[model samples]
Structure formats: C-alpha cells, structure tokens
Target: MPRSPHRTRMRLAALVFSLTLLLVMTTLGIIPRASSTTTAFSFASAGDTSTLTAGDGLNSLNRLAGSRADFFLGVGDYSYQSSMTGDVWCSQFKAKYSNIEIGPGNHDTGETNDTSGTRSYERYVAGCSFTLSSQVVCGPVAGQCYGKEYYFDYPSVNPIARFIMISPRVFNVTGVCTTTCNAVAKSPCNDTTGCWPYNKNDTHYNWTASAVDSARTTGIKWVVVGMHKVCISAGAESCNIGTNLFNMLVAKKVDLILQGHDHTYERSKQLAFNSACTGFTTNSSYVLYNSSCVVDDGSRGFYTAGGHGFLKYAVSTDRIDIQTDFAGTYQDSFSVVSPTTSLSASFTYSPASPTIGAQVTFTATASGGTSPYSFDWNFGDNSTAQGNPVSHSYTKAGSYNVALTVRDSAAPTPNTQTMTNPVSVSPTPLSLSVSGPSTATTGSPVAFTATASGGTAPYTFAWTATGGSPSSGGGSSFTTTFNAAGTFVVSATVTDANSQTSNASQQIAISAPIPPLSASFTYSPSSPLPVLPVTFTGSATGGTQPYSFTWDFGDGSTATGQSVDHSYLLPGAYTVTLTVTDAGGQTAKAYQTVTVTIL
Candidate 1:
C-alpha cells in the first residue's frame, strides 16, 4: 500500500518523541538499560615473581572476570629479578586479556642495581589508563604516575563512586642497613631505604588526605580505597602502620578499605577506634559492611602455583557486591552498605526569652527525611530531656544551654543535631512577710502568716518554725498554737512556684498568774457572853497587790476589807470565814478556829 505524505510525517514525529523519551529516562536512571547494570572489577597482589607464575594468576583472574567486569586492579610484584621479566609478564598479561589495568608492584620496579626500572614500567603501562574519568595526578610525582596508586570516578554508574589506589611502599621510609652499608652511603634502589620513606615530608600521606577530602567535597556517596598492605587484618609485618592508615579511612568515613599484603584471604567487621588511643582496646565497632583480605598463596612463598586468584567487585548504585575466587572456585562473597541520606534538623523554643520558673516548650523539626523520627535532648544541666515537642520547667535561675539531636531509624546515626541559644532563667525575688497574733496568753492559740509577692505562677509555700510544726500550703497563712509560759517564738516559711523560699519569726510573751493572799482572824475576849462583841483582827499575806477580802460570820455578818474584826452574836460557837482577792482577779479564802467560853 502507498503511504500518504501527511501520515508519513506524523509517524516520523512519533518516532522522534519515543527516542527523546528514551534518552530522558536513561539520563534519570529510570530506564532498564544494559549500562545500568553494575560494572564488575578485580584486584590482586601477585607477590614475588620468583615462585609465582603470572600465567596462573592471569588465568584465575580471567575466569573470575565475568562479562560485566570493565577492568582489573593489580598491585606490584609482576615479575622476578629485573624490569625485563616484568615486561615479559605484562606483555603476556595484555595478550591474554584486553581489559586489564595494571599497577606497579615492588618486583616490577626491577633490581636494586637497575635505575631505569621505574621509568620503563611507567612507559609500558601508560597505554592502559584507569577506568575512572576524574583521574588526575598531582604533587611532586604528578605526570609520571601509574594506575597503581591513583583515584578516579566511575561516572557511567555514579559520578560520585570514588575509587582510591594506594601503594604499600609509597608512604614508608626505608631504614639504613647498618652492617653492609655505611651510615653516609645512599641506600641501594628497590631496597627498603629507597622505596619506603616514613618522613612526614613524604607527599604520600598528605596527598592521600587531600584526595579523600576532595572526594568528600564532591558529595561522593561511596569510596573504595585499595592498597597493597593489609593493615586491619590479624597478622602482617606492616599491620600497625596499616592501622594508622585505617584510622585515617575511618575518620574520613570511607565506605570500603581494600588491600592485599598477607597472602591469605580474610575479612573483618567495620572497625571504629579512637585515634587518640594507640591500643586496640579503645577500638569500637562501626556499621562496617564487610572486609576481606585475599592472599593467593597459603605460604609466604610467592612462587606457589595454586595460590593465585582475584576478587570480583560489582559496583552498583546501591551496594558493592563482592566475590573472591581462587582457581575459578568461589571462596567467599559479601557486600558493602550504601551511604545514608543526609538530613537536617532545627529546634525552635517558643517564647524565646523565658522568665525564671516559666514553662519552656520546644519544637524540633527535621528536613530531608521521611516522617516518623526520634529525638534526643540534652538540657546541658547534667540532665537529659527527650521528646519531639518537649516541654520543661526550669527551677534554678541561670543560663541553660540546650541541645537537640534528631535521628531516624533509616539513618546509620543521628542525622542532625542543633544547640539552641542560652535560655536565660532570670532570677526572681520572693517577697515574704509574716503576720499573726502579736500577743497571746499562755496555752493560747496563735496564727502565723507568710506571704510572697514575686515569682512565676503556681507558687509553692513552705512554712518552717524553729520551735513549732513546719507546714506547707498554697496560701501565705500558717496557724499554730503557743502553750508555754516563757516567750514563744513563731516562724513562717513561704516558697513560690519558682522554688524560692523565705522565713520570718515573731516572739510572743505569755505572763504568769499572780498568787492570791490569805487572811486569818483572832478573838481577844477571854470570856464570851451572849450579844457581846468580840475583838477580831485579820492579817493578809502573799499577794501581788493590795488585797481586798470579804469575811463572812456564821450570824450573817460580813467584812469588806483585807483585814477585819468579827464578834459572836450568840453564846454558841460560830464559824468565821475570810476571803481575800488580789489585783489580777485572783482570790484566796481562809478560816480561823474561834472558841467562846461562858465565865
């Protein structure tokens, strides 16, 4: 059938749209593409070439390298004797596998007498560059660098997947041989004195730090650090020095540390330790995914045939899957954890300036994270405060520094921590006053009152008396009783809501009762007759003031003075009673025995 022009143009437009969509999806990593799959790589340290055959190791690496692998990582020790053997090994290595990236090993640098080994090795391997795009060499040994000890970025998978190469002997300082060499004699090349320089001026350590810092600044999500020394393993001559470099890796939070020194394959848990402490006891465990040390040979002798192998690492967006293979046999496998997404949190306390005893409410919120999180609060007063929307009351008056650390279960550790400005708890004076009965009699009731004026709301009152009961109340008044004759002191203590208290005391005197006087009467007549007046006298004693006495005779006669005389009206004997009264409303009664006889 003949297609119309208009229909043909529409079909072409649709095809263009489809291509554009495919391109966009690929760039966004949303499309399932062949390149999207992880790219695998292998690394191995082919030790001394004397006993180790490069052909066997190359064969093992070839079998381990799956179709997905893009390149290979090699650490020194390529050949034995001189750089010529090393060249032969390299030529053989290239002839067998076209996708291999080689690095300089100790043996590849030729013999101690060969001065041109370094330059020749560099020229031979310069053709095979690193797979990473951002590979750059700097410092004193910049342009002449090899792929053995360098850093690069794999942008096809992730622009931030940084791979750092480390040379075992790069940072070490060679020591002078005392027996065979003079102190002033320059150490022979390829010997310990020529390769490893431990001096601080050595650019290795500084350059390494700089590389790590640069990768961190670039927001690199994962860092794969490869070296030729096994520092974290159980046994190795350079284990301690390797530990120092390991400490640096931990400080930088590098995702994975890869190295080969011990000729055996071993793995470890992520290691965390205090750099300040040199001992292993101070080491702590971090969220380490996994670690492995691969030694192709069981014995230290590098010439062994079956001991050659390589490690295959599949780098993906999420994780770095690893598998170790020897003689084409899968020995062990593990993976590295992905980096956590960073989050930030900020805390804002309402009523920024809170007075002493005021309730301070805090609200902390996090950004760049999913909902449902936890918070840890440090009130900075030797006390811990916690909660999302937490509230606290400050009793003491001072500047309280508060910190909020926010975290979520998805994160490896706390995502964000913020310290709020010093919340000043201003000092408040508690005005106190006492009011009660100023004077009271003995065994009388008295009330003491304590009033406070300045403080926050919900004031608390505490009353303490030195010689009385201590009570607390919301109001300012406190009542008590005074029972003794001596001067009784009453005290009242008042406390506000801010927990501020004040005390006041008052003294009250209770006067004792005065004793009353007693009066007695005597008759002067020797003989008493009917209707005869008898001389009667009364004496008063023991009284506080002038005594007024009331005397009552048996015949209904009475006297109204302190002392009085009474006469008998009848011949029969009569009873007389005298009553005395004091100034303080006290009275005493006395009776005298009188006899009337007929003459």
Candidate 2:
C-alpha cells in the first residue's frame, strides 16, 4: 500500500478496540512509524443513513478515520432528506469522509427527481481515482466517473485488494433509474419466477460480473461487494433480493457481500446453490459454478439488525478476517481463507528512505502462518532486531537489505519463512511552507507563496487547493481564488531533482462579501405643524437582517424602530436623517427634508 507521508504508517491495528466509535481522523495524532507486512486495514460501512440515522453511521465512519481504516464504504441512503445547500446530510459525510466511496440507496435518489445526493456524493468524496481501472480494483463500471457503480483499491497498492460498490435500487451503471442496477441487462426475464428483482435482466450484473472476473485475473486476493440492499436477509424482509442474486455472487466466488436497506445485520453461512436450483446449502461446503472454480455457500457470516454498528476486515494475500462490531463491541467474527494463502512479509519506514543517523521504525505483520509467530529483522549493516516492531538507525547513507524471517507454531520444527526488500538510506534535505492570508472575501483571489529549503538543485512546486487552482510550473509561489465561503485546505508539493517530494499545507477561510446598506424613511405628515404627532417609516436593503435603526428628526430628539411616531415643533427646512446599521455592523444614512408650519 502507498502510505501518505502525512499519516503515520504505524499499524493502528492495536488501538482498534480501545477507541470509541465517535473518534474522528484528526483526533488520532499520527507519529512517524513503519509499515507492516500484512495490511491490517478496516473500513466502516452502513447504509440507510438519514438525518435520523446519521449519528450511528457517522460514528462508524469517524472511528474508522481515527483508526487505520483505509477507506469508508457507504452502502447508500447517505441522507434522509436533501437540503438546497446540502448542509444537513451531505456535510456530515464530508466532514467525516473526505475520501468516502458511496453506493446510492433508495432514499438518496428519491430526495430529488434528479441528482441531489448523488451530486454531493461526487463533489465531497475526494481521494478517489480511476487510474488503476483494471488493477486489482474495478473503476468506472460503465464509463461514468465515480458513478453509482464503481470500485477502487484500498489501504495500499499491494496485497491485491479491491472494493466494488453497486447501487441496486437507484441508478444503474449508466446513471439511469433501475429497479436493480443490472436488472435491465438480463435477457428473457423469468417473470414466471419473478426473477430476482435486482439481478434480473441486469446490465450492471454483466458489467459487475465481468469487472470482478477481470479483477480476479489481476491477482486480487480480496473482492468485497457492497450495495444498499441484500438478498439473503431473514424475517419477512419486504425488499429481500432473494437467492438468485446470492447464487450468482457465491457462484462467481465473490469473497463478501455487504448490504444496508433492511438496516439489520445478517451474516450468511458459507453457502452455495445446487446446480439444479431447487435449494441451496451452507457451511463446510461449496458449489462448483465453473469448470475451474468453486465458492462457499452464503450462510458463513452473521448479521446485526437495526444498523447500529459497523464491520472491519483484516485483508492479506491469503485470508480475510472480519469482525462485526456495534458500539465498539465485537458481536461476531469469521475468517475467509483464500486459495493463495501463504506467509508474506513487507514493511515501510517513516520519513521514508531516511537520511543517515535518522531514527527509523519498522513494523512487521505476518498472516497465512500458524498462530504465535516470531519475527527476526536483519538490517544488512550487521544490525538486527528480534521483535516484529523495532526501531533502528543507519550510521551511513546507502542502500541495504532489510529482511524479516518468521517462525510459526506448526510442527516440532516450526514452519519458517523469510522475505526481504531493499531499504534506502539517503540524505533528506527538504522543507516546505505555504504562506497565505488565513481569511479572505469569497470570490476573491488569495495569494500564496510556497517556499522550499534544502533538497537538491532545480526544485519544482505543485500547488493544490480546496476551492481554486494554481498554474503548474517550477517556482516558489502561486495564487488561487475561492468561490465558496469556508475553510479551504491548500497544499504545495515540492519535488526535488531526484523526484523525492515534500509538502506543506495551509488553511484559509473565505467569507461571503458584506452586503451594502441603504436606508430610507417616510413621514406621515408632509407638512406637519408644530407639536403635531407624526409617524415615520424606516427601511433598509442589501444588508444582513435584524438591523438597528435610528431616526434623527433634526430637533435634537431621536427614536428607534422600523416605524416610529415623532412630532416636530416649529420646524422649517429641517433635514431628517434615518441611519441603519446591519447585523455585520455596516451603517448607511438617508435624509428627508420636511417643513413644519405653525398651526
């Protein structure tokens, strides 16, 4: 997995059970550490998210962010209701998951005739790309970017893992409304049997089936399918997709199927369909749907109803261990073993490729081996460590071999395995800073200067912003403009001559422009006589509401309020001024000339 330099590579697998489900990403302060052998990543997923049910899903996502979860998968129904500005439900998801992946549910589509929830889903969900379209992950199911149907690689680039999101009740691959994403693709609908509402005539099915099949060819070890609705749920479920869809999934050898809609947790057994299609069987058995492959039945996993918690998985090259959790408690767990299961080793260093004399941490994670394994680290330079996670430093700068050997509890001789990789120790002379105004007016350009120190000659800068753009080139600084009023996270990356990169970030808040204030007033009596009672009406525009009003009657007496009565005694060619102050403290004045005649 490619590690983000900003995030600590240390395994969060240890703090998994300690933190509550409400912890957010930033609260988990990251320390510089090393990556592990097996990628211990967990993703929190739940659907039927609405204003009412948002708290639980949010807790799950927040906990995932705080932990080492690679990414979050929202089954669907992200929002119960849609707001014009998308602040209610959309912002909640954005605040939690800037890198969220979504599948549309029934509620998200019905909130609007067209795309309201979908639009927000695409806009706020960053950190997703289709560049690895066919590399262990499925991307752009039918030529649509982050379309309701798509897939992506998670946590890291290795261990060969992928996540597929399907929107059965909402739009299909082409963004067209369909009962099931793939229902229209199936030929000769079996209305006689009420063909699976979702998989029948399903175009998404063909595309998905093809996508997963192709992904499998790219050496994927884990393939998880997520959707808003499920097929094998129990207890008179109204929208039960039934066994037809389940049959296809199990038959096609999909590792796991995550669903929402019923809002209940239900885990299926290792289940599969009989070739004759009369009935299906589960546990300790699998069906051969193809000449060269076979898959377990659906009864191997358990479920939790009412959608209270989340599910986390430990993915590796050979096996996947999943835990069904609700409220920080593990309700159930099971392991799915893959055919390619074996002991493999991999590790990463923080301040990656550190300079000589720099402290470096290494974490070694092992799976596919017998329980109670021991690790040995060999740092090529005659330095070694016995434990899995240990820190070391290289006195000289150069490339060296770093290997980890593991011995598991097997037979009397213990099964042993070794894996090695090249570790580079180089001089790290890089520092970066992005300086700009912390606050600005909306729609105005904010000038930012990025300065870099140390690290080779001929340095280059790449700038990115939350609401604007900067010209791409080699330089020290650039400028960008923001249209929306909010805190924008801007970053600048400096690439040295050797292609090593260092980045710095700045937060800028752009506020909406202050409105101009205009004040006007009218008097009840145009030609008021001395001491005659008169009424004055005051009004203002183009400013924030709840304005403070003041009326100067030219008699050294004043009154307040939108409308007030005043008397002018012995008035002649007097000017009356109405002053208005808006909520933002902006003020404006208007004058009225009035003549008071003696009665």
RMSD to the hidden true structure, all candidates: 24.4, 32.5
Q: Tens-digit lDDT track for model 1 on 1-599?
A: 11122111000001111222222232233422222245444333233222233444445545634434566656444443343444455555556555555555443443232333224345436544454444545433544355545677665444657667666453211222322222212433233543433123256666777787887787776676655544444343345234445555555566665554344443322222223433323335322212222112233321222333555566765555555555533244444533234577888887777766677888888865433677888776777777889888776778888888877655454355464657777656666677776676544456767666666555556555443433333356676554556666665666666577776666767655444466676666746666677666666777767767677877777877644555675567667787777776667777765666666
Off by over 4 Å in 2: 1-37, 52-61, 82-88, 111-143, 169-202, 238-244, 266-307, 328-330, 339-409, 412-599
Error of 2 at 44 (Å): 2.4
- How accurate locally is residue 192 in candidate 1, as Cα lDDT from 0 to 100? 52
Question: What C-alpha lDDT do the candidate models reach, one value each?
Answer: 0.52, 0.59
Model 2 lDDT tens row, 1-599 = 22222211111121111111101111222221222237456565555544423344446556656756555566665554334223445555556555456666544544232343333444322323232223333333334446366676654555366677765534332334333323333333333221224563376566677767776887877777777665443323443444445556666667667776554343333333235554334434333222112124545444333334556766766566665555443355545554324666667667676787788888877776566789899998999999868889987768989888987876677777888878898765778888989999877878888988666657888877756754343467777877888888888899888777899988988889976889888887777888888888998998888899998888888888989987776757778899999998889999988888876
Off by over 4 Å in 1: 1-55, 64-67, 81-86, 111-120, 127-133, 156-158, 168-201, 233-236, 240-244, 266-308, 328-330, 338-599
Best by TM-score: 1
Clash tally, candidates in order: 18, 36
- TM-score for predicted model 1 compared with the true structure: 0.41
The window of 10 residues in a row where model 2 has the poorest summed lDDT is: 17-26
Assess candidate 2 and give its TM-score to the true structure.
0.40
